[model samples]
Target: MSHDVDVLALENQVCFALAVASRSVIALYRPVLDPLGLTHPQYLVMLALWQQEPRSVKDLGAALQLEPATLSPLLKRLEASGLVDRRRSAADERRLDVTLTDAGRNLRSTAESIPQTMIEQLGMPIPELQALQSALTAIIAAATRTSELTGEASDE
Candidate 1:
């Protein structure tokens, strides 16, 4: 082992960097999401739904890497806001189906500019942002695969 390598330093810890960046970037979305009546987590849920509606809670939880316990409350709030509806799936009574409401569908138009706004706010180029997102997605996939092999993914 080389004495030049300081493994204990915070700067050298990828987990620490990822954790800090995640918190900071989510924080940046707070102001941007507030006007749309969404928390960052809620916005993420909406994004998923906007892409594909009438999905099961389980499906959503999987896609968002969230748990039913954490997702149920958010769904309730979105429902209360008149943006979504939760119903029993037609084929399966046990599964809860979540679908966007008319209001929710309409909100997509308003949200179209949000991405550009955030990029402009960050003063970051679109290509750079795309690259960063790709890198993060890769990291998440690698972590998930490793976790699955180790049986830690059972929590998901």
Candidate 2:
């Protein structure tokens, strides 16, 4: 018994589900990240940098799938928080690079526990969490593919 309702239409809205899940997950991370003095975006940058030091800004932006303008302010905030440093390339004056500081490296010890804590909080088994991550990665890849295809058509 439906009164002008389209449940299937609502159920098909992947964007809505994605937005809800992303917001909920980020919210769960806020308190856990607070002590480390990092926001979700900042934490993401640190993850990238933790794997490699002294990445060029352009390369970092590309690796993170972020535009420079969006990443710049986040990097500035990380710099202000003493977690990251931005400097010009010694040989290439035109290029700016980012390096994690000692404080940033130190913070990793604290952050190391975050994933376990979040898993406990999420109450999901490790296998289930891994499956969820794999699913999300595929969804992201498909979304990116669709965007790239549309962008190429538009450009042509």
Candidate 3:
């Protein structure tokens, strides 16, 4: 407790709280999503695809905040699971497009109940959970925007 300590001390770190909370939430999701044959990262990829049916690998990586190196392996796993298909873009032979297969599309039926399961698991009221989700969504959006802006600046 030195008075000369830096202002950026661990006790005042929102990042630390965010990281701990995120890990805890993901842990809660593990048992629920496990039966669906999805890891947290894989579920995130599915969420993106569900929102937008087909997207290029580059686009998916950008949306998921992953680099191709990290994303490729995950995509491979999903492809092997028969949940997604990665094919060469006919319009651009150099590019790859990832599309959810029929099984992947059908997974939404099973997954739709996950939100309720999570609420029951957390024992939180829907309103409270919605508030938390909103706050986290905003934080993620701001962080993504910041990263994108910084990336663009660095590339110039």
lDDT of each: 0.91, 0.89, 0.90
lDDT of candidate 1 vs native? 0.91
Residue-level lDDT of model 2, residues 107-147, one tens digit each, is 99889999999999999899999998999889878877888
1-156: candidate 3 lDDT, tens digit per residue: 477876598866878888798899999999989999999999999999999968999999888878888899999999999999999999999999999999999999999999888888889888988998899889878876887877753112
Candidate 3: the clashing residue pairs are none
Q: Please provide TM-scores, in order, for all candidate models, with all chains considered together.
A: 0.93, 0.88, 0.82
Count of steric clashes across candidates, in order: 0, 0, 0
Give the number of the best model, judged by lDDT.
Answer: 1
Cα-based lDDT at residue 119, candidate 2: 94
Worst 10 residues of 3 by lDDT: 147-156
* Of candidates 2 and 1, the better by TM-score: 1
Q: Please tell me which model should have the higher lDDT, number 1 or number 3.
A: 1
- Output the worst ten-in-a-row residue range by lDDT, candidate 1: 147-156
Deviation in Å, model 2, residue 148 alpha carbon? 1.4
